[model samples]
Target: MAAPLTDAGEFESWLNDRLDSLEVDREVYGVYILGILQEEESDEEKEDALQGILSAFLDEDTMEDVCKQIIKQWTECCSRSAAKRDAEDAEVQAIASMIEKQAQIVVKQKEVSEESKKRKEALLAQYANVTDEEDEAEEEEQTSGNNFTGNDKSLFKNTNVEEVLNRQKQKRDQAREDAQKKKEMDKMQREKDKLAKQDRKEKEKKRTQKGERKR
Candidate 1:
């Protein structure tokens, strides 16, 4: 048979004795304490809120001590949570800064590329103008040669002029072919370099992501 419970103090003393004799896991007890202490209420509010429940098994002085311990634990927990939030915010800011730098670099590279394209077009236009002038000069020479006499000396002069024009035409055609080949090679090399650079950037990006994940 169980003993009859009498006064409030006697009942609380019995409850405390029962709680002390219980076989509870330390980890589970810790989790339960943490759950109560981590509430958003202020220290005073939390103490007051738990007063009625704890009074069932704790005396005045013991309950006060328990409230103090809870407040201390709660303050420490809040501090740790705030520190974690600060670290995460700093990491996010660093990533944003890196992305901004990458964007700036891309913009600068695009500007350089546009400038190079413009320069190439300008050079091609200049080369075409020079070729046009040479053609006009060659036509004038042919017209003058046609007005010469049929004598041996004049015939020799006309023959020499035709030979010079033919040699010039052949040289011009060879120069054009060489220029085209060089342009193609330059374009191929640029494409290869571009691919290599892109690959390097991708590798670097992967490494950065891996490092971040590790953190």
Candidate 2:
């Protein structure tokens, strides 16, 4: 068996800070101790033994239930000693005080939770604004700048608007301007060749006429 609780102070300390999983067992243990005090145990001895047998457990409401049962049994079965009454009274007061402190702690925890929630909401709102700005920038780049969406790339089979425009420029130069320039250069070279042929024919005709006169 586990060692018994040795002090009245130990009960209240456990009630304030110990795990709640054992609460039912502790309350049931309190009931068992009450049942055993029906015999002629000294009030002092009973209180001390009760402490050693049961750790402090239960909330204020449940504690009041256990205290009522213990007080009633002590009065009826044991001697109605003043010291025992005083001691039980002090124990009841201490339990009440611990309950009040727990209530205050709960209120403080709620306030802190609300503060954390507010901060989280503020952070989310700020992040949403930043995300909106980035989305706008991307949309503008898609419409006007040299960028392409995945759908745009697949649909057009091109990277960006700039590439499309540059390809169109090259097509225009090849189809109209470059062809016209080649035609003009050909016409000039043909005219120059014709003029040289005409000059040579005229000079040959003049030389033939002079030779005939000399003969």
Candidate 3:
């Protein structure tokens, strides 16, 4: 018997060898042999069946030995073909498993990214709220300082009391400067009014002397 064929290529090669030795039409007899081998039967049964089938088309004396050889070779070829198909199936399963693993990894990465994005947004929102609260507290502190008396030390806990006092001092100094400027302006206006009254009186006295001279 021929050694088992390793793959389809080796099976084809073995089939061609059989055709050459048998001196049979490759297309006709090759197909007939393949069909007989494909039948669900025991090795002896298939061999006997093929021997009987080919005897009508071939020399009876040579057909028995050739049919037996053909059965052995083709059986090995079938066994090898089955093994190859099993190996291809296993390879396809392995590739499918790898693809599934890669897809799972991608899904996990996306989940992690989405979780990180949510955490970042949450942190940003928290920070913004803190900033707004601080701004409002600062505004309240500044406005509350206007009503501050020397007795309220608790109100200055979140603010610098010395800085508020300095601002108040600066405002008082500005008010004093504005009051001084207004007082100076009033004194200048009073001096201008006195000078204009004296000039009007002198003009009236000159007109009275001219009237007496005309009389």
| C-alpha lDDT of all candidate models, in order | 0.68, 0.63, 0.78
Tell me the spans in candidate 1 whose CA falls farther than 4 Å from its real position.
1-38, 141-215
* Clashing pairs counted in every model: 0, 1, 0
Candidate 2 has an lDDT of 0.63
Local accuracy of candidate 3 as per-residue lDDT tens digits, 167-195? 99999999999999999999999898989
lDDT of 2 by residue, 1-215 (tens): 22222233433334333324444554456446534454425555555555555445555565555544454544543343445666899999999999999998999899989999999999999999999999998888875453355665565555456688899999997889888998999899899899999999999999999999999
Top candidate on TM-score is 3
Query: If the candidates were sorted by their TM-score against the true structure, best first, what order would they fall in?
Result: 3, 1, 2
| Tens digits of lDDT, candidate 1, 1-215 | 21121232333343344445533233344344444544535677667755644676678997777667655645655566567677889999999999999999999999999999999999999999999999988876776676543475577787899999999999999999999999999999999999999999999999999999999
- For candidate 3, the C-alpha RMSD (Å) to the true structure equals 10.3
Over 4 Å off, model 3: 1-12, 57-64, 148-215
Candidate 1 Cα deviation (angstroms), residue 88: 2.0
Q: Which candidate is the best by lDDT?
A: 3
| Pairs in steric clash, model 2 | 5-52
